[model samples]
Target: MTAVIYKSKYGSTKRYAEWLAEALGADLLVRESVRAERLRQYDTLIYGGGIYAGGIAGISLLKNCFPAAEGQRLAVFAVGAAPETPESRKALLSKNFTPAMAEAPLFMLRGAMDFGKMTLKDRMMMNLMKKMLDKKPEEEREEWEKNLMSLWGRASDWCDPANLQPILNWAEN
Candidate 1:
């Protein structure tokens, strides 16, 4: 059986985790309170989190346990503002993860961003980012940074249930 582990801020990744756990009928784990050694109990692992400035969900989990969690089928899913298109797939997978993680199966799901849920720091940073972007000439702005600020999928079931088919397939295999 698989365990669904997630690290969510502002509930976007939590929503995805709930949907995934329910659909797969798997046990769910929230990263903050998880027992590190307990991870060895499952052969299949599903780790998920919302994106923030191009970082993975539960990064601490991976850092603390990836080296010890042997014989597990690790599949990562990121619920982000990125679309589920090929461009997004390329960016999400290629830009993130270490060599070991890059070797593991990865999926990108659409996540929401609520300005209201953002902290005062995040708001200030966003404002600074916007102001910086404005200072740049449109043609001179870096492609990657532009995409980072432009969230394609917002406030919907953009993370399609069908996308989790890979999880099912992986489990079956």
Candidate 2:
């Protein structure tokens, strides 16, 4: 038995979760609805969440309840605006997961960005980031900053089912 759980802020993560759950014939559960006792029943647990400020939304579910699922297979997928490169993935895992939890396989998926739907704080942060990027020469900006600049004032959807393949393979095996 496998459970696919997610915490999505603006839908990208939820979309991926839906695709994954359907593909795996697993239980689809929201992060908020998960309980430690319930988690013990699953032979495998796959958690997905959107990246926000160097954190995975609703990741507390795993950090707080994983003991009950000890010895069970665990995997995590993170959806974010950043490109999925080895460096980015390693950085995200290091910043977000605890030492023990970091041992699990992690999959990174590109996500959508909709400024209009973002919270005021997120908007403000973006504004600040924009100002900083503006100060940097084009050649000096990193790939992520360049991508962010391109996404300004527009919504971009990079959520595709193909990105879930690696996770599916891991879960199935």
Candidate 3:
């Protein structure tokens, strides 16, 4: 097994990476810590990131550090507070991945959102997005965004291990 590189701002994605690393007996690293010199020895590169609005972070930069990783055994996963159903999963990939990214193995894992743990910028960004979308009727916004804006409480265990088998299989390959 090679390394699982995670670019997590909020800890959810990193949690999955750690779990996967433990499962595979591999090194778990943050993307920033993986320079080209550091990553060249690894045969597999897995990138995990969280989603906000509609974009995935850090994975886009992987090509720069590990261009060869593009054709290798690459896996990606995202953790989010949104429900993980076939429909929600579809929306997540559509929102985050470009057409070129569709080929990489993709996984959607449920994640927690704690309003209190959020940084000031993230808090403000969520609030601002909510307010901007508030002008529209409730029915206009997508279901996921509606759930994303609801910040009344904290949830810690959205990354269900039962749903982690796909990741296990991918890493094993």
Worst 10 residues of 3 by lDDT: 148-157
Q: Write down the TM-score of every candidate.
A: 0.77, 0.94, 0.79
All candidates' lDDT scores? 0.73, 0.88, 0.74
- Cα TM-score of candidate 3: 0.79
When superposed on Cα atoms, how far off is each prediction in RMSD?
3.7, 1.3, 3.1
lDDT of 2: 0.88
Q: Write the per-residue lDDT of candidate 2 for residues 86-149, one digit (tens) a residue.
A: 7787777888787668678888899999899999999999899899999999999888889889
- By TM-score, is 2 or 3 better? 2
Itemize residue pairs with steric clashes in candidate 3: none
Model 2 spans > 4 angstroms off: none
Per-residue lDDT of 130-156 in model 1, one digit per residue for the tens?
788778887886664566456422333
TM-score sort, best first:
2, 3, 1
